[model samples]
Target chain A: MDKKSLTRRLGRPVLGTVAALAMTAGMLGTGPAKAAESFKIGVVTFLSGGAAESFGVPAWNGGKLLIEALNRGGEVPAPYDKKGFGGMTIEYVLVDEAGGATKQVQEFRNLVQREKVDAVLGYVSSGDCLAVPPVADELKAFLILYDCGTPRVFEEASYTYVFRTAAHAAMDNISLARYMKSKGIEAKYFAGINQDYAWGQDSWADFVASMSVIQPGAKVKTALFPKIFAGQYGTEISALMREKPDLVHSSLWGGDLQAFVLQAGARGLFKRAQVAFSAGDHVIPQLGNKMPDGIILGARGVNGLAAKARPNALTTWFWDAYTKEYKVFPVQAPFRMVQGLLGLKTAVEKAMVANGGKKPNAEELAAAMKGLEWDAPSGRIQMTLGGGHQAIQPNAIGRTKWDTAKGEMTLIDVEYYAAECVNPPDGTKAVDWIKAGFPGAKCK
Target chain B: MTLLRSVPAASALAFAALVLAGFVLPDWAMFLVTMAFAKGLVALGIVGLMRGGLVSFGQGLYFCIGAYVSGLMANWTGITDIFLLSLLGVLAAGAIGTIFGPLLANYRGIFFAMLSLSLSMILYGALSKMTTLGGTDGLNVAAPTFLGYAPEGRPLGLALYLYTSAIVVLVGGLMRGLFNSQRGLIALAIRDNELRIEYLGASVRTAMAINYVIAAVLGGLGGVISGLAIGHVDPEFSFWTTSGEFVFVAILSGYLSIPAVFVGSILLEVVRSFSNLYFPNTWQLALGIFLLLVIVLLPRGLGSLTLRRRKAKEQA
Candidate 1:
């Protein structure tokens, strides 16, 4: 071949490569633009990094599964379709909030303004939930708050477009307290180790209040609020050991919890006291045999009573599929995803009905979300509008047990606590809830 | 002289275009541009350190501090005003930087970077454990407030983008001006040969301390804007990866110009956003791949790429 022909051939390949690269870039850049007509739903959660990955990843998976199921199964059949809207294909834009509020807002704004997503879903952290409500209200975008358990998201400001299906900190905390009382574990000198945030603070407050109410003189000895994802827990463990409390309660989920438990167990922290965790089922099973024996662990919405000889098909299917795919049992995180999808499914159907079979935009979806109720794997739950923009939802508790045959963490003797039992009564909320249990009632 | 003067105008025009695109273009495009500017602030701060031959791995500490401080004030105090909250954040970070200044002055190379990283990690630990301060969960940052008007609930896409662009422009100009000063020359000299600068009766440590303070303030300022822009601040801000990202932005921009840093920041945000949009699970991995490509293909950084191309043209 002549030098000129060789040069021309090289030039052709180079041109091809450049064109290919540019085309790739253009395609990657215009993802949301291409999917504009689809019912765009944005999922904001922690999908990368550490702690959030454990729960947030599962939550995302569960959400994806739900979406897949909705798409696969023609419609939600019966009650779900009674509202008049059924069978609509949806597209989702998943964005990592990176487990931070500011990033969440940035991602949320991008979803609303840039992608022009019709609705938003999936937040694993309470802080993100609280951070996003105002933005959602501003955009008039319907947000299905999932995973974030902070009650403050709805309580402080009313966003017509925002609704949370996940059990709030208060709900989980109050339930744990009731479970503790039921167990007759009245030993005092309480100690707490929680992540520093609304959920952590609120959970600690509710626990203390509920414990004080149920068992008097149950003084909290030490309160250790560690930064989320603390690589080491020896120092905090040492302090907890020194305090020498009879019962130890933690809401430590994600990577931090795994690190803490490993370090604490190695240091023999579990041997000294009974342990109660808010998201116990989620974390312990992942621990496998590493989870210490005899630690009284509690998980959110682990109704042991519901798992008789036979359980609901949805619950059974979720458990079987999750284990088969992820090689781990479904936990609180996965359950939260189920709830989030259920919330979306419910709202979309309702909005379709309200709009007289027309597709609902952000405003219609937001309106449909108010006072939303649906049956989840955890059973039926409702998002009731509380004072300000807070959400009132039910909660449950369960003791952790190792299923040796299955090689998994299972909630054995679980009890479902009603929302009213765990919730703060009108005038007396966190303050009164902390006092010794209804001094007037005689074990009724 | 014409090129120098036109730089600001060029930037202003670019920013105006971005803002206009927020209305005319798709929402996703506007979002990518906004993120690009926001991340640019962090990159510029890193450039300040790089200019003095310092590679900071602890920028996240100041970033987290500024963001969390603003977030806390907004949440606990119910002060929805962005400027006031950001001011409080800057003061908090500046106070800490002053203390950190003398301690870090003598350190150089990896030691300086490692020390900074440790400091940020410690802050992360402290924030995570401090329940009253919102711990690992972080604090909610309110929307922008101009005088008495709240911009968060309004037609948010435009005003927010404008605010971000304004900050980026103001900060970029200030950094550029600083880089052109005598101190900037000294900084360059120190990077070239610190021992010679020290022999010339200059207190290398003192100069470094001043530089560090300035960089810290800029970083804190960036954090506040980030907090306002994002509406949430958490302990993760102080993570080593956060600081690494700022470094990445600086290096990617070629540590050359303020606008280049912003461009790099935007590149990163857009790439990450797109990666997540399509790949879903592997956005971080995608970012890693992109960073590797940038490192191999443009060794002098993206800014240097343009400079080198210009020089090649002149030579030809």
Candidate 2:
């Protein structure tokens, strides 16, 4: 084609397209966003990254199962069988939390501003859990952090619209320490290896501080903090072996946990020391026989085998339903997710009553959830910290035992601690509580 | 000088449009554009370096530095004004970028990219270890005041939006002027033939260094705007993947039209938000396919389309 014809062809079409786009923008500029009839909830979880399999997917699975069941009306157990959240049809908007904190901040805003979800209830990454609350409070969107273990979210700052339904990392390590002392496990000259992030550092600090109180005069040999998701543990394991600690503790999770176990197991680190993991139960099914026997561990709470050991009607229904759905026993992630959902259901229903049976707004939801207590599959959850924004729940610890006939790794000699025994009281920080020798703790 | 003669006037118009947009657009759209504008500034820096034949894989280093400077100042000294924070961010990132520019100018191609990558990774490591700064959890930036007025709700969102748009326009105008100036043409010459430029009595390293510093200033500006809008900053700001996104926008815009940088960034944010909303499980895949389609159709990126049409008109 001639140059003049080509110029006209390209320029005319491009100009037309630009004009069309501008028209669309003008149209969009005028319309105000409205909501749907269903009680929409934005569920954020890791659906596609390193944490997806061990934590995010299982948590997402639990959310889908419980939410769908609630919508089905009769599949759920009593008092909670009212169908969906206060008879409003439950519609979920699932978002992948695989991206980092900044991306999560953007996604959180998108969920609130664009999707118009009434409440958001997922964040496995502690970084995300910490980053999202301020935005949530600013936007006045209700947020329920289901799986992140950072105490800083509620401790460092208070939020009116944000709540976490699971106990923070302090509970996991505190319960671990108390369980060890109660079982009379020797812990002198202890060493720790944990991921270097907030979750890992907090877990290690609590364990050491609690050990100082319970097993007084014990010396800390060394604490190695490798970067999170750093698969290789050769150097850290060698360092631990050299220290020849009487006990070793780690709070690693996800692929990091599995990789650490396999690497450390090969070097017989568990045999050399009374090794313990603060949040290790989720790795049980994946590691199977690879996980060395007699390694002390906690699921971060009374979950999986701990919940099974003290079965209730809710526990039986949840465990069976989860296993029947996923073909594996529910672990810490799914259990934690279920408990959070159950708590939300109770809160939503309660808020509905107060809001004249309409789907309540964020303010009503926050009021309903504050200081709320409800029965969960694991046990009861109470919003008792951060002025009724943070949850404190019972947690358990145990030793790994391989069952030959069952062909699975199981927990034996499991011990569960009451909520008051592990979590810090209101207005007290986790680190301070541990360093203060865990005063006023009720350990029964 | 002729590359984009109309850019100065166009950027001013864009600034006016963006300021008007904040008043009419919904909160979500305003936020999306604000964020995109910030990111586009970072990409603009990458383009500045690209014109001097240097491709940095570590702009996130400056981004994180700027974010932390503004965030820490707010958290520590209680300086909550957006304008003051933006100035500090630009100064801090620019100073640091200046220190590394001459050293980096000594290298080229893959070596330059790798060294830049290492620089960002080091920042990531250092920030991750600093537990006092909230470690990997990072710190929250409170709502920044516009001049002394601390607005809340939609007004705060809109204020941040306007502030970001104004900064982008201001920088975009200055960059356009620089790109068409004598020094800018020297950098472009260095990109095409560094040895020839050196033989022609021009200091190639100096030109490269100048471009590097300019890029750093732009990156810092972006970081400040983002810290204000997102209300959080973490080590992830310096992560390699984050830098990769900035570089992607630079590549997608193709160091051609200055406005195309913002277009590319805004397009990416829009695509990401919509696809993630519709296809949560396969959004990354959807993004990959979209990128592939764009590259196939526009070989020199979206900017080249404008260049081609202009060339055809001149021939006619």
Candidate 3:
């Protein structure tokens, strides 16, 4: 076609399209500005891979429920009675934490820089928790580590913008040891088996340190550390059976814990020794009647089906909502996640009030969260450690009793420990505190 | 003349583009590209082994070694210089490779793959059990200083991207040269007919061992850069699945040009990031389907498309 005819043919349509595009852009741009401001939170947890079934899914579900309830208004008790954070609706962008630490760091940056999230909550792996804090601090973004149990995130490198809402690994082990002492479980020989990774190794070290203080003369017979997600426990169980220590301890969680219990139970290892598990509540619902009776265990805190007995209204609401939605009782993971969200809610609301009910910036949010206190499904979580960057919360420990008729594993002879009894005090390292026989600790 | 012939103009242009990317790309995209380049180097090492008729299911052993060595140096010795750390990482992996190369040279096919996997698993076990190295939680490498200058925040990321890009480009050029050298030809010849090469008075084992060592150094380089960029190293770096990822990327790139390996790695990362964001629960399924499509439609992988286009242009 000739140039003039071609230009004439295309000009009208091109002009029409440009006019439509400009109109659409104007229409779209105004819509978002008029709506109530949204407080964008990046929620990261394991949504796939091995951890998803036990920890990641439950934690993600908990975050989802909490955000939904908060957006709908007045789902939680007083102090959290207002909808959203200071009247701005809470919106979450979920990211998978299934990949290794490197990918997680990249995803975290994407959440902050690309998605423009104001704050981030969630990391189920200690490795991820350790890797992300520095980046978060550098970016000056508010980060709440919900479920990772590492104490090093705070103790090793202090960050102004990073906080862990759950108590560190030391608390779980110390509380369990305290429960054992309170119950008068006399044992001369102690044997422990834990996952070989950081979480497992740290838990075991804390347990041993606490045992030395609580049962000074007790000898450790054998210590086994199988790899994480190893699944097979035949050799380890056989080794434990051979030692036949008076007391056996393990910190295995998720599918690894389930596998170990089933294999050990079949081999009758539970009968030979009084066994104790830190972070054991995850497997109770999965094991049901299969869970051994009278084996001492703790759920990292006062979490899981065990917390259903707590008399708090918020606890009851969370338990009922989670159970009804998931068709299974919430475990330690969900409990930690809820605690994190609750703490975030309190911090945001406080910051909002300080800022005259407008959305708070990262600095204001961090300021508000420092030393914040709030009620959770587990109990009261207080920022009492790590210069107020770490949380200390009370936890319950008890022995398991399998009720065959009910097809459930129940916590019996349950005992609660105040946060001050277990967690390290501010400015003291956990290992150092335990080595010093928990100096200045007040157990009640 | 040989050096000039071996170096492709496209590689030089690509390197320049990557260096420029640091200034223009967003922080997250720059981080993603840096990682993809690092991982792509590991994939190139796997490709090197493939050309020698060898497939390692555990290049992650050397990769992990490089990362851990760099991390340990920073933690124990307080050496935060990236150049020195990179040198130490390469030397450490190369030393291990030299020690194990003789034993590995005797094995081929599935035996080589299994032995590689076994070696990596042993490292994984040891890393998991050693509490001082942070055990399974792994140790963090301090934010590396570039030439003794400490940069923080966006500057640190940009510095890392530039450093990583330069290393990848230099390595790629060296690899291309090796592909055309007498030693490289000898290695490929061994893959085709080891007996014939031996009959020609060439030492097959020595050639294979040399290639293996070279591959180890490349893997180590990739790991060190990655560890520095990410600021953490763990036993998962040596896990069998990690090695499998290298193999997967190598296969996806095909046994073709070095740049194809980088392209393949970048594509994989993009797919993973987007899928994880949009479909968290089904990302794995999404990756699986992508692999299925690639395998079915392009047996020689995405690399063949470039060759096909070139041939078509020549025909026209």
Top candidate, metric lDDT: 2
Worst 10 residues of 3 chain A by lDDT: A25-34
| Interface RMSD to the true structure, each candidate | 5.5, 4.0, 9.8
Residue range B1-316, candidate 3, lDDT tens digits? 2343448665677788888767877787778888898899888988888888999998999999989888889999999899999999999999999998888989999999999899999999888878878887887788899887999989998998998888888889888889888988888898899999999999989987887898899889889988888888999999999999999999988876777788778778777776677787788898898777566555676576666656677799
lDDT of 1: 0.70
Candidate 1, CAPRI quality class derived from DockQ: acceptable
- For residues A269-317, what per-residue lDDT tens digits would candidate 2 score against the true structure? 8889998988888988888889999989898789988888899888898
Docking class of 2: medium
Q: After superposition, which runs of candidate 3 have C-alpha atoms over 4 Å from their true positions?
A: A1-36, A402-408, B1-8
Q: How well is candidate 1 docked (DockQ)?
A: 0.38
Model 1 over residues A291-400: C-alpha lDDT tens digits? 87665554555432223212676666666666677775666677777766777777777888878877788777767766677777666666654532234445556555
Can you give the DockQ of every candidate in the order shown? 0.38, 0.51, 0.30
TM-score, each model? 0.84, 0.95, 0.92
Candidate 3 TM-score over all chains jointly: 0.92
lDDT of each: 0.70, 0.87, 0.85
Regions of model 2 farther than 4 Å from truth: A1-37, B1-7
